[model samples]
Target: MEESGNAIGFLENKTILITGSTGFLAKILLEKILRIQPNVKKLYLLLRATDETTAMQRFCNEVMGKDLFKVLKKKWGANLDRFISEKVSVVSSDISVSDMGLEDSTLVEEIKHNVQIIINLAATTKFNERYDVALGTNTLGAKHVVNFAKQCPNFKLLVHVSTAYISGEKEGFILETPHKLGESLNGTEGLNIEIEQKIIEQRLKQLKANGASEKDVTIAMKDLGIQRANQHGWPNTYVFTKAMGEMLINDLKHNLPLIIIRPTIVTSTYKEPFSGWIEGMRTIDNFIVGYAKGKLTFIPCDTNSIIDMIPADMVVNTIIATMMMHKLQPPYQTTIYHIGSSTRNPIKPGDLLRFTCQYFIKKPWFNGDGNAIKVKEITTFNNFASFHRYITIRYLIFLKVLELVNKASCNCLEDKYNDLKRKLNWVMRQVQLYRPYLFFNARKPKLSFRVILAKSLDLMTPT
Candidate 1:
């Protein structure tokens, strides 16, 4: 199939507000819009002010500093940076704030006068974040954006970035669907959002009163988010709060023309803007690293379980293409689009493991051992316990006798066993710390955000 440009004149001369402009998906989307729809009037980036002069510095250091925009730099030369700086202005903002962290009259007027579109991607993508931060960044942040969108004079589309795993506590065909979350999430969909905010404030105040370090406070908040997720039936704070955000967006953005693009497990770019432009790897990369380390031996996963893997580039292309179609067809607004690879392309975890093994044999980036981690499939029962039992009875016990000789001889296999035990203990502890959401089930609250996905699919037939 021929790859066609997804963005048309849809963005021409239009002022767009893009949140999460520094993130993986946002990077691709921003680059595509800039490169494809270069004439888009102004691009307002809403990012938190890390320090003084935050917006421009963040735009340069965060967004344009990466390798993803290298092509844009080379092609446009000096004009590219200038274009981004001039046409693309930054607003030091926070999604957790009442007005998306943009309270300045000038910036507010800039948005009301010039901005025509709002794309909210700013979020705490950390799966194990604090409940308040997750809620603030994910749920309430969207609310702030919606509220801001309501204030815009000539607002067009308010695109929300939601995850595909919003439907918690249920599992099945996992259709392109949604959930009616009235109170199940927080013991009473009526579980006052205001109360939670107040509690967060109180907790933070206590932290400050105790003179807690910023790092300590952050850690405590993350632990709280994880604890909250456990209290609820979801995986972790990220998806849980994202679920709440989806529900709130559905409830709050009633009058606004909005579409939620729910993409699943965004990976490296498969094409466009730049192919395979990946940096820090997270979910899939961990799998690759484990396979390379020869440690992820026995995985307990549903092999037929259809792992939905969509390339970030494809997702971005689909997102832009959807916007174009939506511009042409207005009713496509207020829908949730699952830009997941569940439709056509599917590569399972086992498949990924095998591929990593093969790839590593060819080009190895191994650990400090100087010896590559050997990859071999061990039986399910043979992970650590049963194998340990057999080895303990047969080999470890024998080695115990030999250890006396080995201490006499140094470098004994018995000593190796002890070292391995210590290492495995450490690994298990780290894994447990991150394991609040190994098995998660949440449904889409509604396709209210999916109109863009349908429109894009109709335009490009990606699946």
Candidate 2:
């Protein structure tokens, strides 16, 4: 990461186990820690693979090969292999599976002897995941990992990457603490885990008994997640399950040395291994895509609403800082840190939308016409007409025009348009799955907006 120097705290000669190593946050953390400390004993990256070969393939193709590490590559020169072999390692695993999917005895023994610090970044961030599926991944998966953590003889700290929305509905100021299950993040009563789990399991069983295949069951479950969201005022299964998982962990943390980092919305790096080196699908990327296609003319966010976000590198730095601090701090409550720039670097979604729209106008995305799509300024309206118009103008109009071209010239553009429509619909369905959180009329303003705005403006503007 592009920092002034090292840091106030560091993880030197520490063995760490990381879940979700293939995840966005994990990749940054792994890269930064290894680069900064250089002396950290070893890193055990848990992958959702069956064995070493599959895990290694994922590590190379997804992790090491990314453009984000180009700066470090220059520094390490040809000694990268020796560095990776001596310090970094990968272990095939998944939280949803028992024992973190690490069934390999030799690997387990190696971990038992080496890894002492555990960073669990594995999470199903898709807001629309099914309850059963979410529980399997978010709740049960957490339990499995923590159970594994408990078994670690030399374990010192466990930092769980949780969302700030764990606070749920009632919003004013969300303090950092364990939001125990059956207790809401805002102090409102929440669903009991046992009851919620039983209900989901029963529904799944009914679907199975009806001769539903695995795919059929998944579809059924996804629908159930949507229904659950509607009932609970949440948008999807992802947040619901994560909230539940946080509660369970808070309830069960007991005497465990743990910390929960509740990051609001994570965006691209401000300064890292390199500037503007963005990768993967994220909220910012989605906004960019919408801007490219001329589907997002206006943002449906509060002008003063806080789109709390922190850079990936900053969050990683905070993770290492918190871990290092806990190692030096005395035992007490589970440390909960809100790692968001909304306090010191708030950037409105509307402003972001404006900036993106303007950027794309000069360097526009072209189709066959080599002309950008036309769009008018839009307003925030929850009515069906607003959504219907968007679908019609942005998607339907484009497809209809393609079909017209196909008919006039007898071209294969018709099939292409149909495929594009299918892809767009899939994305919309996923968005609708997490509608509650995104569309929730909650604007947390406990953090200062002016300072954050000033900093963001400075970053957006050139040096």
Candidate 3:
């Protein structure tokens, strides 16, 4: 096949292996590629499953059946089945395991021979994921993918999808470069990964030795992950482990064509594969849904803080364009691409708040009683102390009154009120946990904010 300036022409005959095909980003990538370039040789979708049958089921239900692929479905019509059979294949594998947990030698050999591009998109995005799980999937799992790439004779590019937050609780400009673990940022030394990993292992062993229940072990591990993250200067386990994954790739990418795409808070599609298409609730979407339902009243945030967000379809486009650039322009070295909008077209928390209110005004939501839950202007706080004070003075005192009433009423409503009290306390704890990001004032000289420089994709940088 002759490669041309046209992206579809360039991608015509190359086989691609994509991990995390069931994920949000990967599904969008897959749909865009199939919809635009049906002539591409094949797509190996690696997903975690017990067998190929189960993997196919997941691909059909979770990926193809999703609203993201509706445009493609309309185009293919009666030929959709034939098109999918010719273009897509599912491999039952887990990124967290060695050799991608592939048991079949024949299938492994097939991948080794035909796969030219490997996209590592599988990762644990849970902010408080268990330490062992995060380490194995994000850190060690990445190492395994690199090893697999080393064996592929035709491998050309490995595009690792990462997050911009991997810069990790730092202020000022974050360069498009791989940062080493324990490397000083602003005169502060980064976390010692080796020592931290050992600490986590020891804590788990101690918990097991104490005959802790499974639930207790899980909770202990989650808490330990967060503690280690904060102790080492990072905000959470998700970003810390993701940063480690990047470091692993950096060490192993010697002489290989690798590009790391660090995208900021990914939102719905802006243009392609239909507009405003999004899956289940993302980070900020949680607040939107809760607020719309009138479940969340007060939130803690600095209105002026810049929150970098990029549309999912834009990320998919950038990924494809970057891959094609690398293919067309050979001898390319490892590069980091920060695909975000802050540096180009900044969007603030205040802007999002305004948009949400405006949207709901045009399209109001109603409660179960069939009454429009006319949303009031959401109250915001500048700091955790102030937010905590408000919660304590208003909600906590009210709960205390309920407790007293229950005590006076022969414990009549005590059980129900106690449950509500516990839930309120949990919400307060979550608010406290997330206060740093919410109330972040990037303008403060001492405060840290991520600055992603998007120099890689000069072709379509946001205006």
Candidate 4:
């Protein structure tokens, strides 16, 4: 983990349970744990599956089989299977359900007695996911994990991986301290978790009873999440529900050894476990891909605004360090740390765009016609109206003409125009969902990261 050299030793004989093995952050964390401390008593990966066989399959196909673990695979060689079988085990469990939804009593007992560390990484990262799914997995899921943690008699620490955006719309100086109970980081009154859950459930039940179609249900729930999020002072459903998840942990911690590490816009690995390794398109990666492909010419953003991001490996290192530091300490209160780079080494949107364009110029992507697409300077609009106008003129106008042509031609174009219109509508939805984050220009001057880390890490911040 590239810590101060003792995290691995500290985890020597510990049994650890980690949720969210399928996620990018958890994948890197698992690889690092196995690569660094092979002697760990047992590292259980709690995945969503029907049985252990399916869980193992997912563990192999999604986690260990990825390129991130190539080095470890080569190191273990012929004994790779044996080592993994002995040191790593996958337990099919969904945190959204009660008691982590573990049906196997044998496995439950195994974890209750042997598991000393619990790292909950399971979360729905979709910024515009359905409210029901988001609330179920992000909010109630934390409650279920907390309940399970209480059952773990030997639990040394419960590390809940959260997002730094839990601060919501705060302008500057987002602190690393745990947000106050019953309030958002921005000082907005927080929702009662139990009450909110009941409200969502009742609303969903009413929708179903009213004979709402699935499509209507999805749209209604999406709008509800956004409306609630805006009313609650958060940016979107992802951050809003994650904040509730953190709140649930806060209410339920009850003197347990807990460390909540909130990382910002997690990207690829910086150095360890293979540099520059990343799985799916993360928060900012989508923007990079769309821009490089020339599909996204306009973005609503303040180019000079600082975009905080941290390498995945750095986050993993910090997680390990936090766990190790807390393992030997007394059972204390909850602690939160914001793991990000903006306050220390800020990367502005303009800088990111420039780097992205330059990288594409050096190693451009080829289009379907077998020619490298020439990268263009990104155009940033100050507001959504300007962005919408640009998109309408640049893309929608042509589609509109095609629609007229298709109509005049009596549908001779075979729904091509209709398909394009559908795609454009979908793109518009995504843009709307991402508008606030991309277009934000905080009034608060800046946040001091170095000092926050110094305070949060107990003066042992990673180098």
Worst 10 residues of 2 by lDDT: 454-463
Pairs with steric clashes in candidate 3? none
Per-residue lDDT of 169-194 in model 2, one digit per residue for the tens?
A: 54556666565556543334545677
State how far residue 262 of model 3 sits from its true place (Å). Answer: 0.4
Q: For candidate 1, lDDT tens digit of each residue in 213-299?
A: 989999888887776665666657788788778777777776787777888778888766656887675666765676567555544
Best by lDDT: 4
For 29-75, candidate 3 gives per-residue lDDT tens digits of 89888877788899999998999999999999999989888888889
The C-alpha stretches of model 2 lying farther than 4 A from their native spots are 1-9, 184-190, 213-215, 229-233, 297-299, 368-434, 437-463
Off by over 4 Å in 3: 1-3, 181-198, 327-332, 367-371, 411-423, 441-463
Note each model's CA RMSD in angstroms. Answer: 5.3, 5.6, 4.2, 3.8
Better of 1 and 2 by lDDT: 2
Candidate lDDT (C-alpha), each? 0.68, 0.69, 0.78, 0.79
TM-score of each: 0.81, 0.82, 0.89, 0.89
Q: How would the candidate models be sorted by lDDT, starting from the highest?
A: 4, 3, 2, 1
Clashes of 1: 28
Q: Which runs of model 1 end up more than 4 angstroms from their true locations? A: 1-6, 50-52, 177-181, 185-190, 202-219, 328-333, 369-373, 378-463
Model 4 TM-score, all chains together = 0.89
Q: Enumerate residue pairs that collide in model 2.
A: 47-93, 181-247, 235-436, 344-452, 345-452, 346-452
Candidate 2 RMSD computed on C-alpha atoms after optimal superposition onto the true structure:
5.6
Query: In angstroms, how far off is 432's CA in candidate 2?
Result: 3.3
